[model samples]
Target: KLRIRTPITTRMTGCPNGCARPYVAEIGLVGNGPNMYQLWLGASANQTRLAWVFQERMNLDDFERTLEPIFIEYKKSKRRAESFGDFCDRAGKEELERVVNEFDPSQSLVKTTAKPRVSVTTETMDRLTRISDIRGLSPSKLANEILEQYIDSLETTVHAQK
Candidate 1:
């Protein structure tokens, strides 16, 4: 006899990008604002596919009501150990579209807008120079190595706390 672990799904809110990367989890909820959310479903292990935007700017009340049924249906129909992404794919595009549309008709027309590019400033240049001085390396060399390492460490520390 073999025991199987059920697929786990997780939700997070208030992330800057609303956790659009579906591959990151079986179910991911990203906050669009105070009472709005974006949904993502899937995992990267299969193919690194992203969840299609199911609904954009959904009110919290509507999200709770609409998502419950969809998840319930998924649980009922899903093959043993099937991930949400794989389930969606197996269920086909029409079914996924129906679910998204049933929750919010606007979902069909909603498009994710690209964020504006940021320009580096003189202040950033000075900071880079300071880092180079501290590391006893040229700006180009420090930029390639120590700067990324320093930033990555900071991010790691912050993420660890969360």
Candidate 2:
């Protein structure tokens, strides 16, 4: 589990069906119910390993309390541009547990589900699958928008002619 991260991204999900695929996310949180989430970490982005359960049945307050100190320690411990999942894998379970146990939740600043969800082009999805990485945003949104503008312009010209 000490290998380098193949991708650099994060994700979140509110679906019980695991729509966000938290099982393989570097930092994945699945919503169990109102204000309750399950935390998973140390997953390889390339789907090489399913993430381990770092914590379960966490409330917003608990999420904040549990994650902040680990983040701080990661900041101190990580190599250049290393990701959370990669850091988690290299740090090992015992060390992560030690950090989790030591962190005081009172100091947490962001105490809720905080990762972004984005849509992408099918082409982008294909590239992601090919590359073993998950960049959160999609280039297709922009492409679709521009295509709409072009269509509108064409329609305007046809309408004027008619």
Best by lDDT: 2
Whole-model Cα lDDT per candidate? Answer: 0.62, 0.74
lDDT string for model 1 (30-116, tens) is 788887877665543355665555666677666545555456556668887777667765776467657645665343222334334
Clashing pairs in 2: none
Clashes of each: 0, 0
Q: Give the 10-residue window scoring lowest on summed lDDT in candidate 1.
A: 107-116
TM-scores, all models, native as reference: 0.46, 0.55
In the range 4-83, model 2's lDDT, one tens digit per residue, is 34364466799868787888888888887887888888887676877887877788657666777777777779888777
Q: Which ten residues in a row have the lowest lDDT in candidate 2?
A: 1-10
Show model 1 residue runs off by greater than 4 Å: 1-5, 18-23, 44-47, 97-162
